[model samples]
Target: MTRSEVRTVLLDAVRELRPEFAGLRLTGNEHLGAELGLDSVARVELLVVLEEEFGIEDEVDPRIFMTPATVNALVDQIVVAEGVCR
Candidate 1:
C-alpha cells in the first residue's frame, strides 16, 4: 500500500486503541510516547496493531519501537519490514 494509505490505517488503529487521539491532528512527527503520552504498554499494543495490520510475520525488532519518536518514522519501519516503498 502507499504511504498515505498506510498512514491512514495507522491513524485509524491509533484512534481505535486510544480514543483520546480521535480529534487530534497528528502530523506523524509527534512522538508516540513523549508527545502523545503513550506509555510502554501502549507502545507495545500499538506495535501489535501495526504488525497485524501490515501482516508482518517475524518478530519485530525491539529497537524499531524504541527509535521511532514519530508516527512517520514508525510507518517507515513498517514499510521497510513489509518490503514496500512509498
Candidate 2:
C-alpha cells in the first residue's frame, strides 16, 4: 500500500483504540507515545489492532510495531511489511 493509504489505516486503528483522537489531525510527525499519549498498554493494543487490520500478524513481528515512534515512521514500517507480507 502507498504511504498515504497506510496512514489512513493507521489513523483508523489509532482512532479505534482512542476515540478521543478521532477528530485530531496526524501530521505524521507526532510521537505515538508522547504526543498521542499511548502508553505501553495502549501501544500493545494498537499493535494488535494494526496486525488485525493489516492481516500480517504472522508475517510481521508485533514487537516491531510496538516501539515508540512517529505515526509516519510506523506508516513506513507498515508499508514495508505489507509489501513483503504474506
Candidate 3:
C-alpha cells in the first residue's frame, strides 16, 4: 500500500466505524472529536479499530491519533516502518 492507499483505507474505516460522523468531510488537521462529535469512547474505539486494521502495536504515540492528518501521518510512518508499503 502507498500513502494514498493508507489514507483511503483510514478514511473508509473512519467513516464506517462512526456512522454518526458520516457526511462530515474530513480533511487533514481536522479535529477528530470536536469536528466529528466523537466522545472519548468513540475515540478509543477508533484507535482500537485502526490498530487492528493496520496491524500496528502499542508503540504508536497516543498524541499522533488526535487529528486526521496526524493519524494518516502515523499510519504512513507505521507502514514504512513495517515495510508494508514501498
Candidate 4:
C-alpha cells in the first residue's frame, strides 16, 4: 500500500460512485464538491464506500466534505485513517 495505490483506490471508488469520473484524469487538485459537482448526499455515499473499502473504523472529519476538498486530501485522510502506508 503506497500513496499512489491509495489514490488509485480513491479514484476507483469515485468512478464507481459517479461514472463521469471514470474517464477523467485526476491531478489530485480536483475539489470533491465544487470541482467535482458532488452534492451532500453523494459526498456521504462516497464516505461510506471509502470507509468500507479502506476499513476505516475511525470517524472521518466532517470538513472533508466541504468545497475545498481535493483528491489528494482524501487520499491522505484514508491513508492516515487506515495507516496502510506499508
Best by lDDT: 1
1-86: candidate 1 lDDT, tens digit per residue: 57887677767767777788898877888778777777777667776776687676455664566667777898798678755545
What is the alpha-carbon lDDT of model 1 when measured against the actual structure? 0.72
TM-score of each: 0.71, 0.72, 0.51, 0.64
Candidate 3 residue spans exceeding 4 A from truth: 21-25, 67-86
The alpha-carbon root-mean-square deviation between model 4 and the true structure, to one decimal in Å, is: 3.0
Candidate 4 backbone overlaps, count? 0
Candidate 3 has which clashing residue pairs, if any?
none
Q: TM-score: which is higher, 1 or 2? A: 2
For 1-86, candidate 2 gives per-residue lDDT tens digits of: 35676677767777777788888876867888877777777766766776677575676556667763887887677656557432
Q: Which candidate ranks first by TM-score, i.e. highest?
A: 2
Q: Which RMSD values do the candidates have, in order? A: 2.5, 2.7, 4.0, 3.0
The lDDT of each candidate is: 0.72, 0.70, 0.59, 0.69
Better of 2 and 3 by lDDT: 2
TM-score (C-alpha, index-matched) for candidate 2: 0.72
Candidate 4 pairs with clashing backbones: none
Residue 27, model 4: lDDT of 80
In candidate 3, what are the lDDT values of residues 17-77, reduced to their tens digit? 6786578776634555555555656556665766676676574454545543344555655
lDDT of 2: 0.70
